[model samples]
Target chain A: MSRVDVGALVDEARAGRPLAVARLISLVEDESPHLRAVAEALSPHVGRARVLGLTGPPGVGKSTSTSMLVSAFRARDLRVGVLAVDPSSPFSGGALLGDRIRLHDHTTDPAVFIRSMATRGQLGGLATATPQALRVLDAAGFDVVLVETVGVGQSEVDIVSLADTTVVLLAPGMGDGIQAAKAGILEVADVFVVNKADRDGADTTVRDLRHMISLGRRELGPSWRQPIVRTVATSGSGAEDLVTALADHHAWLVSTGALGRRRAARARAEIEAVALRELRARWGGVRASERLDRLAERVAAGALDPYAAADELVG
Target chain B: MSRVDVGALVDEARAGRPLAVARLISLVEDESPHLRAVAEALSPHVGRARVLGLTGPPGVGKSTSTSMLVSAFRARDLRVGVLAVDPSSPFSGGALLGDRIRLHDHTTDPAVFIRSMATRGQLGGLATATPQALRVLDAAGFDVVLVETVGVGQSEVDIVSLADTTVVLLAPGMGDGIQAAKAGILEVADVFVVNKADRDGADTTVRDLRHMISLGRRELGPSWRQPIVRTVATSGSGAEDLVTALADHHAWLVSTGALGRRRAARARAEIEAVALRELRARWGGVRASERLDRLAERVAAGALDPYAAADELVG
Candidate 1:
């Protein structure tokens, strides 16, 4: 926690010592007492890695695609860091994550690192910690950082919010194309990938996605039209195309000055989250001190409203 | 904002004046500057109504089920208030919500009040506003309040967090049962209804739900076994069964002392959110004063970390 411990740890992490990176991530995930010191040490070494987020519904071959993408990235000799933030995800479920045995192609390669994040006890806790973890990976000298998250609920939104380029993966006949629109992922995706392209409904799914994307462009006005890449991730087919699409999106982000803007927004959110968490702790203390118990009883009795009770506590 | 204005409004709202209740909800949704005064005035006269939350994916016939439930409740002479807090939801989307034209069944009935909420612009803002809106409904002397929210993402979790009993609606094959499970709705539902039971795959869906419920019970340990009700919401079939399930859950909550605990937890969350927002506004000012811009630049250039920068600002 002190400057001394952080200074040494930073050197180790920067040197790409796996132990150092792992420890640093644990500190951030647990919100260690000396996190400020760790952040201070890390601040000087991040922002080098290209952060990519791939998300989709369950059974969408997202993990398979991620694994394939890892291979493609490695083939180009780029060091990669993979963070699976959705542990409950069937894509990266219990059997797939430990040592990433499912990703046998890259497990033996020291050039790649993979980690699975467990659910933080509180809702959105993982969200608050994700960027910091990305920082750890970035500072560790990874050329590319891939965050694979489940594309559902608010958790998915939060997971991808920090990525420089967000790729939404899909498969045919899982009925996810409609679900994607319903969940509003269509708005956030930077690249759309149809995995399992050899399946019976793959072309139909691709057509549906194209239709939605065009509809979206008409509504939002064409900017960077998301390219659809078809792939059979399990067979490693179209891995090169998926990578090219992602790279193209990243290039587009930098060209449009959106990358800088996104980073700024992400930083703003992170700072606010940290500040709010600290403030909430004190606020909880204030509520008990202000006798919110009595106020709550009255509110529960139809004698007072919760808003009025909250006002009294805040005052 | 003054004591006098709040006092008058509270009186009118308690007297069941629809205008007064609507105005109160608007104030809460907007986070009106004079909200403290309004809260103080309406602090009492809430907590009498049983708040029921109905949530499910789009096209699950939530509105139809809600309509049927309203009619059933009215048949028993119970006054009902329906809050459709999903403006984008197919059930309560623009057209269905404006005047609740879809519920022509109850528009003219003096025993019912229906309103739909729009998004509050900020993430979790609607979540923060929803409790206060419920209080307005409760203080307005409605005996039963039905809150219908689209079951997707974090919003649904926040929306249903306040309900005394939560009913999760699912149609035969909108591909939501598994989606719901992935979104963690299974943990929150007190009752599950397979609406559109007249359709194909209805039994299969119900069986899937039952199997999942059994798996959940075995994993989570049995508390109150969530009953799976079959319904054709549009035709009013099984409306009584759904009501009975909800009632049974409510009674069980009371008998087990879970109701008080749940309410306490909900209130705690609400208070913390309020205090956090106030502190965040102040934190924004501090970020500028503490030179977060310079820190962000350093972090961006691989010379500083976000955690360290946040610490300096917090200090």
Candidate 2:
């Protein structure tokens, strides 16, 4: 965590050294004391990577789709960085061995880097850590950074805010149409991908999605209509179509000046999260504060209301 | 919102008036300006109701199971309050009409009250609002409050923390063993309910769960082992067993002194959340801050880092 070591790691990461990139990301994930220094050092080299987000429910072939998309991006000679985020798991770093195994095809390629993140049991940990890790990959000069999160909860939705374009994947016969609507995925999706298209009821899934989209059509005035693409990710079928769809969405974002807006929004959120974390630290945190313990006891004992207790503590 | 009205509402709610309880919950949901008055008014009658949490992934007959449990509790003549929290939906208050329809049997019962809560599109809205609503129900003299949340994300897990006992439901043929592990449900569940037990793969599901539980056995010393119960919720079969399991767990919690610890922990979290919200309001919030906007612009444009910007804003 020394300043010299941090500077050297950033320099090496900027030069595309995988080990250095991994080290920087580990520092971010661990929430090291030197995070501000690391962020400051990596600042200049960021804002260059195109971030694409992919999310879907369990058993939806999100990993396979990510691998297929990686190959497609690589074929276009883009250095890709993949962040496989599993918010449901409390274990972080290398715990998602299955995902790493599935994505082993590019492990030996110097241009490709993959990492898996878990919750680590910290409240709002992924929401804070993911952005910093994304900055590390961005600083490492990856041309396209793909963030793949298991879409089980709000954490994935929060992570998707960091992406320039977000692709929401769904598979057939999972009753995913209602789930997509329920999870509020339709509002955030830039491109709809009906993966596992070879399965039974694929057409029904697609048609149902189309109907849902039509029912909640985006308003006019530079609005980009979300297009649905079908793919058998296991066989890499229709990957080219997905790539084209992504490119078209990216083009629309730039043409409509939405990309900058989205990035600014992301930055705002990141700054707010960090600021709140700092304020919490200053208050000795909820766990460490004796005053909080006393207030909580009173609240639990019905001697005081939580709001009044909070006021006394904050005041 | 006046102090007089809040006092009258609290009096009425304490008298078991359902309309008064619902109005107070609506005020909490809306983040009403008079929330402090409402909290203060409801303070004396709070901390009496036993809170039970029910959560599971979709298609596991959660609504049916909930209905069955409600009937069982009511058979004992215990006044019950039900809170159906849906974090995925942006709409709040009465939007979950389907759930209401499924729970129609208890609508006319004077001893039963049911409510539905959605995200309302506010960050941490449920985390803050739910406890207040729970306080309302607790003060309204309900013997027990059942908090049922759709287990789609971490938000449900957070809500489960408020309960004295949490029941996690799973069904057969859904590959839910791995899913339950992935979603960290194993760590939170006080009891596991294998609903739809008449399904083809129910035995396998139960065996797999047993194996997983054995592998991660809890530590000794006043530990309460989580029990698994099989149920066909559609037919109300095994409802009595589920009730007995819940009662056993509740009694264990009381005898082991874990209930107080849990409530204290919940209160600590609640206070911290409220304090943080107050701090954010003081800083003009993330969206409204001009300083945040300028800092975000610089970070998004690669001229500054998010951590440094956060420090500046916080300072």
Candidate 3:
């Protein structure tokens, strides 16, 4: 489609047309040249849904836990949007696209919309255009948008800043339960889940988590206590507790006027991410070699330092 | 230190002062204000290091393998630089800061420089200032700079464009080995290492790797073949073979002019990454509230779609 067509499609989608929204998300994600137009068209109708990020080390039953959460939110009769951020397929250069396999139970349910996203060569955990996609979901009237990132390393932590509320999931009996505390997991978690709690270490995990929370309380002035919830997602056990924890967190957010603060922070982050992406792409299209060669020559000669060379190149 | 002092320190490091280089790397990784000056001063003496990025799923023995590789390089009397990227802390707002612990053996070896970098809340797998710090290592006379990303999601794939050669490490008995292959591991791997090959499924893992390699060969040209190396990193068994494989990759790079190509690509990617980061940080600081409030209104009113709105915000 022409760039103009992409723009119009986004405009139509913003006007309460679901098909348009879906198509637009596909286009933006595909990174057709028309993405700019489409984003412009849809810009007016986005941003009401609560964006919750679910992240942790893999094998933590994030998908299963996420499925249970989706089900729980659905039982409340809320329209739910799930964005499973998978690792991209090297062959196709797109997301591995396995959310459907994990969330098979929800495929037939119309109230639930699941979209899988790949970084598609974007640097961050979420795709560069994800904020745009979340907007489309929000504009579509979905009550909650769950972003499930490929939870491997720091990407899980990166995803937290992008969401309104961040839920970090951990499975029992794995080294990750202790890792969750060391890898800065405790800081970003608004709500924590120890999934597959039927396992042997569930109790110890809970005790350890409570101890960690107590430690955090010492420095955070009672204002930043992280809540822990237990779940056996395979049987959908403890799902209710998770939902209740979410509600309580939401309540806390509203009561403390943190909701607006959270949203504002996200918006700012989004803007920065986009701007940086644009600048990078632009720089990539320019005289990169000439600049590098000059810098390299000076660096090799011991006349100029590497850091200074970078500033000069950017300047 | 004043920015001028930072600049002079970087300059001294560029002139081959070891202590100055270490101090400069710390400033950059920590994002201290002094970093800007160091970067500015060292800009000329950077980009010479042959960057090698190693990424894999957790428990793939990436760390142990890395330690072994560093030792191997040091054995050849080559100066080595290691950057181990971990997730940054949310509450402390700091990175885990444990590069020394991970490569404890290298602490006393002056020829081996190990820097532990936290994701520092950067969206991408690599931190915002990583390239700069790596440049410092390069300019400081390290012949090879090994970059270990917090391999989490699709973002890890970017390492291919950043390193002179990219190695994807895997362990035996992980059911997800095939899944990882399908998830883009095969595409980025210039050299694949079946680390911890002493395990039971080591042979099977090798066979599976061959099968996956054949599949890739069918689609990609024969020239794109990736060699597999097996190593038990703990006892340093097969470490020599692993080093040989790295040498072979390097030779291939020089013979085919791939070394220049890799360096050029790295320079470009680094530029893109840095540009995006700076733009985002500046934009976040400026457009924080307005973007959020406007987005909230649009979403509430159903006037604009979220994705499109995100696009508009970026525009």
Report the TM-score of chain B alone for all candidates: 0.90, 0.92, 0.85
DockQ numbers for every candidate? Answer: 0.30, 0.55, 0.32
Q: Which numbered prediction scores highest in DockQ against the true structure?
A: 2
Docking class of 1: acceptable
Cα lDDT of model 2 by residue, B104-199, tens digit: 779778789888776535456677888888989999999999898766556667888899999988899875445655457777889999999998
lDDT of 2 by residue, A1-315 (tens): 454489999989888899999989988878788778899888888888999998877667777788899899999999999887754321223235665576677878889998877653556677788899999999899999999876755566778888999998898887644565545777788899999899898999899888978877744323778899999987899999999999999898899898899999999888887887776776676555988899999988888888888788778
- Candidate 1 vs candidate 3, DockQ winner: 3
TM-score of each: 0.79, 0.92, 0.84
Weakest ten-residue segment in model 1 chain A by summed lDDT: A90-99
Q: For residues B271-291, write the lDDT of model 3, one tens digit per residue.
A: 445545554454456465466
Q: What TM-score number comes out for model 3?
A: 0.84
Q: In angstroms, give how far residue B231 of model 2 lies from its true place.
A: 1.5
Best by the TM-score measure: 2
- Which residue window of length 10 is worst by lDDT in model 3 chain A? A88-97
